[model samples]
Every structure is written in structure tokens, then in C-alpha cells.
Target: MQNASKITEERINKGSLLALAPIGVFLVLFMGSGIITGDFYKMPALIAFMVAAGVALMINPKESLQNKIDIFCKSAGDPNILIMVIIFLLAGAFGSVAKAMGAVDSTVNLSLSILPANLLVTGLFLVVCFISISMGTSVGTVSALTPIGIGISQKTGIPLELLVAIIVGGAMVGDNLSMISDTTIAAANTQGCELKDKVKMNFFVVLPAAIISIIIVAIMTSGYQSASTETYSYEIIKVIPYLAVLVGALAGANVFVLLAGGVLFAGAVGLFTNSIDLWGFIGAVSEGMAGMQELCILVMIVGGVIGLIKHNGGIDFVLNYITSKIKSATGAKIGIALLSSIIDLCTANNTITIITAGPLAKEIGEEYDLDPRKIASILDIFASCWQGMIPYGAQILTAVGIAGVSSVAVIKYLHYPIFLLIFGIISITVDFSALKKKKTH
Candidate 1:
């Protein structure tokens, strides 16, 4: 028994450190290369992760090569990873098809014509926030809004990457607080809080940040060059694709179903407009799926590797370390926030990070008499803050790709996430007496 206990302790520590190694590798490769070259493009994120993921395998026990390979394969092919891959493919197809069909340009021109120049950034920010709240996913919101943001930037002479960042920031706000968000669900469930209670607590904590972000975006874009806008021919029918997708998503339609409907609408419109022949449309769809291959591969690698880490007790090790270090309710909250932020950095997926941290956070919450809602809010806030700022994150990467600019450029102009960090810190340090009172009622 003594020998077994000693061995178990050693495994816990070693596995915990090994689990962290991939994250360190990723950060060094991506951030180090960017720093060396003075360009964020110096290292592609997927390549860095691929290398790190391979390294993670080396830390596994001296097992049969086939067994290890099988382990990796299983993680790489998890249902969640496959789902994200499919979404990436469908989204790519829809984006391409929509663009080819002129919906993107028409939507852009229409947006520019409607929103006044002064309210451009403010309007975009609000729209992104609202969409993310309704859809409960930042990636979905970013996909739907980024092209529009890019169009707005081109038409108005604003920096395209910066505008994309604005949309990304707003989307993250909703991702953190939205009732239907996966992050929200994970946090609430882990902390034993009702979803509604968590959302209410988070609403107060993030409200100041939201308002501040709007003010900052408005001020920054106040000098935006206004171009003479022309009204779109207004393909009212084409607009139905986005409207249907949005409404269906809000109605809690399955994501795959929602995406399928959008894909069908976009493809049908492409057929109607003669943008491409049947063969051409099929080719576009195929190419889109091909485009997502790398992303899909990466997701599988991460999921599988993370699964092994969990199986080996790395997660438990970390949770024990953090929980043992907490002394007060305030410290517990801060620790939960920190835990979620660190996990977000590693996963590059806010929802997954929240899920990883949720159970641990709940135990801490109960021990400290901390409100489950507050704990949930803390997890959501820091995760969103970190995820929004990471250049290699899905939302930022997609936005950068669509905007055709440097990720650094986008990061530099992202004032909203920065403001949010400040607001979150303040809220944590000083209890908002009024907000607390409102919540009690």
C-alpha cells in the first residue's frame, strides 16, 4: 500500500507537468516565432500545435507504439472534434457560396447605407453582441459578422483587421454571458447553479465592461472615413438565409441543422443566380471541406491528448493544487478565474476551458460559501477575456483570414477585450453593492 501510494503521487505530478508541456510548446513556438520575426505570421498555429501534440505523446508511459497511436487516433476522432470539423466545412462552404452569390456585398452595402457613419463601430459591436447572445457561440457570431465587418472597413476606409477585432470582442462578451452559451452551461452545471441564476450574476459583472467597450469602440472609430454609400438592390430573398439561420439557432435548433439550412439556402441561391453550375457548386463544397481538414485534425489531436491527460489524473492534480491554495471566498473566485483563463489558453476554446474548470470551481464555491452564480461568472469572464485576445484563437484567426490583415494588427486595435479585463478586475476587487442588492431580490 505504501509503495502504491508513492507511485500514484509520482504519476499525478508527472502527468500534470506533461499535460502542461503541450501548452508551453505551443506558446513558445507561436509567440516566440512571432517575436523573432516581428510578424504574427511567422508560425502558423496549426503547425505549432501539431508539433506540441506530438511532444505530448512522448510523455506517455513506455507503452506499445500501436497502443499510443490508437490513443492519439481516438482523441483526434472524437465526436466533438468531428462536429467542429463539419461545422468548419459547412461554414466555409456557406461563406464562399454566399460571397459568390453577392449576398456578402449586398449585405455590406446595405449595412453601410443604413447605419450612420458615427455609429458604425457602435452598431457593429451591438449587433455582434446581440447575435452571440442569441446564438450562444462566439465562432458562429464571428462567422456571420466578420465578412460584414470587413466590408464595412473597406467601404468606410477603416482598418479591416481592426474592425474584425471589434466584432470578435463583442462576440466574446456574449459568449461569456449568454444564457445558452456552452461556457455558461458548463460553468453553471459545474457550480451547481441554475443557468438563469448564473446569467443574472454575470449580467451585472459584465455589464460595465460591455458599456465601456462600446464607448471605446465609438471613440476610436469616430474619425472613420465615410464613403458615399450606395443602396443594395436589396435581394430580400437572399437575406433570408441569415435570418433563418439566426432565428433557428435562437430557437435552439441543432447547430448542424442550422448550418445545413444555411448551406442549402446559400447553395440554392447560387444555383438560382447562375453563380456556378451544379458541378461547380459541388466542387466549391468539396473544396470547403478540404479547407477544414487541418482544423479537424488539430481538434482531434487536442481532444485525445487532453483525454489522456485527464485519464492520467493531470486534471485532478491541478485542481487539488489550486484548491489547496485558496484561503478565502475572494481567493477562490480569483483562483477559478485564473484556472479558466489558463485552460482557455491551452485549449484555445473558451467553452472547453469552462468545461474543464467547472467541476473544480464548484467544489471551491461550496467550500467558500461563494455564490455559484458568481463562480460561474468568474469562469466565463476570464475565459472570454483570454480567448478574445489570443491571436491563434478560432475567432481571431477566422476574422484575420477574412479581413486579409496581420493578426498583430487586429490585436493592437482590440480595445474592447482590454477594457473588459480592467472592468473584470475592478468588479472582482470591489463588490458592487448595488448589483448585489439587485441580485438578492
Candidate 2:
């Protein structure tokens, strides 16, 4: 819940263009170079981030080198940053433990059992959507659902790419809206909005888009029957942990507690069912923690990098530039949304995009008297949609790589993000609320 470090009045008034160079270096090294190399992951993310951090140190020579390093470290250790990292660990642990103990399979099979074979595609989309919504991370959702989706693909003669696209679409729902999602967290924190408030405002626009996408999936796959293998038995007990996650998130429980409870509950279920021994549970938990290593590193380093940028006035410069053209509430919202989309496209990581865009969007919103809750929704929506669209973005790349297809093959079918973008446009254009009129008058 820690806010960003405050800037002095003089510093804000005298924002330097040089402060923005560190971010530029980061984007060029990570995104521009990837486009040129034709391999998005070719550059090690951590190394590129470190180099950008170094650039901030070099450019801001006012402080001694050691002092600069200290500033970077402090920012990396910010309470908000630490909390985000902790959530990553817990979420990863829950995901690993649940899958190892058959929770994912149980949930998937139970879903498949209820619906007819011909509705497999739409059902699968909904199942993945629910799982991602519960799990609160699209990457985890992709990893968990892709294999099952592949199996269904193989059996039903459904195109693997199509299923991957549907999963990708479903994954975006949680990435943009989940209570614990990094995107949601970043937006809510920076905009000074409650998590529940953001969710409440976001759903008005997001659910309509989700409903439209679901209907489209059903229509597109109307005659397609998944093979007879769709019918599989699942233990009722195994599904309880997943239900706990969904229920806990929706009930407005603290994310940290929800995930911690989920891990313990899932482990207990595994123990009582004799699916895992004591050591095995500990090992599953450790493995899950291990899986979070890459994400943790990226987050910590990015925190440091962003800290240096802000300390040197880079963020102030960006705020000035991005807000300069906004003259109305609608224009301000458009700027906020476009800023997130553009940054996310460059970063290829929606959470990181939101982290970078959130503070700036918050400033713009406050300046224009825009609702912070709606700004939070705009940041999540635009960032997620743009991340979903880019063929080379990590989400698409990861999904296609796992499905053994081209990113382009699945990019076209990511209808959720596209529709979300459309709804977002409509919501911003038509201010149906009396408060909007009151604010203007």
C-alpha cells in the first residue's frame, strides 16, 4: 500500500528531458531489439533491465554512484514491490500444488462433464476464464490450461491454434480484472482506488465484452463435437480448493490470506487423499516458489529501474508530455488508455505496463477530475487488450510456443481483448452518470 516517493515542488516544475532516457533505453533494448531480432525472448529480460538501471545511474550523476545504487535498492524494496513479490510466490505455490494434486484436472473434467460435446469450445473458454479469474495470473492460466486444451484439441480434431486463442482470450479476462492480478493491483494502488471499487466499475464494461466473446465462441464452434474422451470422472474433493480460490477472491478476502489458505487447503486435500506425502507437499511448495524466480527477478529489477527513473525526474517528464494534449475528461481518459496500451505494447508485459503507466494515468485523471476507479479500469483494460493483440507479445508467444504453432495463428482469435477495447471506447464516449455532468457544470 506504499505510495510512490513524493517529488518536491521545484523538481516537478523543472522536469528534465534527460530523466526520460532511461525508460527509452529500456524500451529500445527490450522491445525494439526484439522486433529486429525476430525473437522476443532472445534478450534476457533481467539483463536488459539491469542495463537500463545502470543508465539511470549514469545519467543522474548528481548523486554519488554509491548513493544512486542505494536509491535503486530502496525502491526495489518498497513495501508495495515486496507485497507484489510475495503474492507471486503464494500464487505460484498454490498453482503448482493444486495441479500436482489433480485440482486442475478435477476442475477441467467437471466442467467438461456438464456440457455436451458440441459446446466443448465455449465451455473450455469459460472454464479457463474461471480458472484464470480464480488463479489471478494469465501466465499461470496459460501453463495450466494449454495442455488440457491440447489434449482436447488432439481428440476432437479441433485446431490447436483455435483452442489456444480461446484460452488466451479467457486468460485476458483475469489478467485485466482479477482481484489479485498485478495489472489490477498496479492500477488500483497508483490511482488511489480500492480493489473492490475498481472491480465494481470495471465489470460494467468488461462483462458485456466477455458475454459477447462467449456467444461468439459458441456460435463459431456450434457443430464441433469434442471426441468421446471429453467425459471423464473427477473426485469431488479435488475441486474444493479451486472453488475456495474463486469464492475467496469474489468475497473480497485479502489476496495474501486467500492464496495462503488455498495452498494449505490444497496440501491438506492432497494429504488426506494420499496423493502426496508430507515431504511431497513441501517439495511442491518449494517447486512453486522456484517457478516464481524469473518473475521475481524481473519485478525487483524493474522496481529498481523505475525508482532511479523517478528519482531523476523521468516520470515527471513523461507525465508532462502525456498530459500536455489532454484538454477534456474524454481526452484525458483516452490519453490514459492509449498511454497504457502503448507502453504495454512496448513492454510486452501487461503488468509491467500497468506499473509504469499507473502513476502517470493517476496524475492525468486527477488533473481532469476523471474518476480514479474508471482510470484503474482503463489502465487494466487497455494494457491487457494491447498485450493480447501483439503477436510477438509474451502471452501470445508463450501460448503459441506451448501449442506448437505460430503466434500469428492465435493472435487473430483473441476476441476478449478486442471486444474489451470496443466496450472501453463506448464507456468513455458516453458518460451516462450524473456525476460527470455535475463535474462539468
TM-scores of all models? 0.67, 0.88
Estimate, for each residue in 1-441, the C-alpha lDDT of model 2 and write its tens digit: 111222222235656789778778878998877889987767876777778888888986667999888988998888877777887788789888988888877877787688767787888888888877766778778887888788887887778888899988888888766776767777787676677667777787778889999998888777777667535778989999988877777798887898899999999999999888899899999998898788777788877877877788777676665555554678778888788888888878887787777766776676666788888888888888888788877777778878899887787778888998898888888643333312333
Name the TM-score of candidate 1: 0.67
Considering only N, C-alpha and C atoms within 3 Å, which residue pairs clash in candidate 2?
Answer: none
Query: Which segments of candidate 2 are over 4 A away from where they belong?
Result: 1-13, 151-158, 226-230, 430-441
Instruction: Give the whole-model CA lDDT for all candidates, comma-separated.
Output: 0.68, 0.79
* Predicted candidate 1 versus true structure: per-residue lDDT over 168-261, tens digit per residue: 8888876765644657655665565666666666676678878887887787788885674655465655656666765665566665666677
lDDT at 387, model 1: 86
Q: What is the lDDT of residue 300 in candidate 1?
A: 60
Native-referenced Cα lDDT, model 2: 0.79
Candidate 1 error regions (>4 Å): 1-19, 60-62, 117-121, 127-208, 216-233, 327-333, 339-384, 387-413, 422-441
Model 1, global lDDT: 0.68
Spell out the clash pairs found in candidate 1. Answer: 75-304, 76-300
Model 2: residue 42 alpha-carbon error in angstroms: 1.4
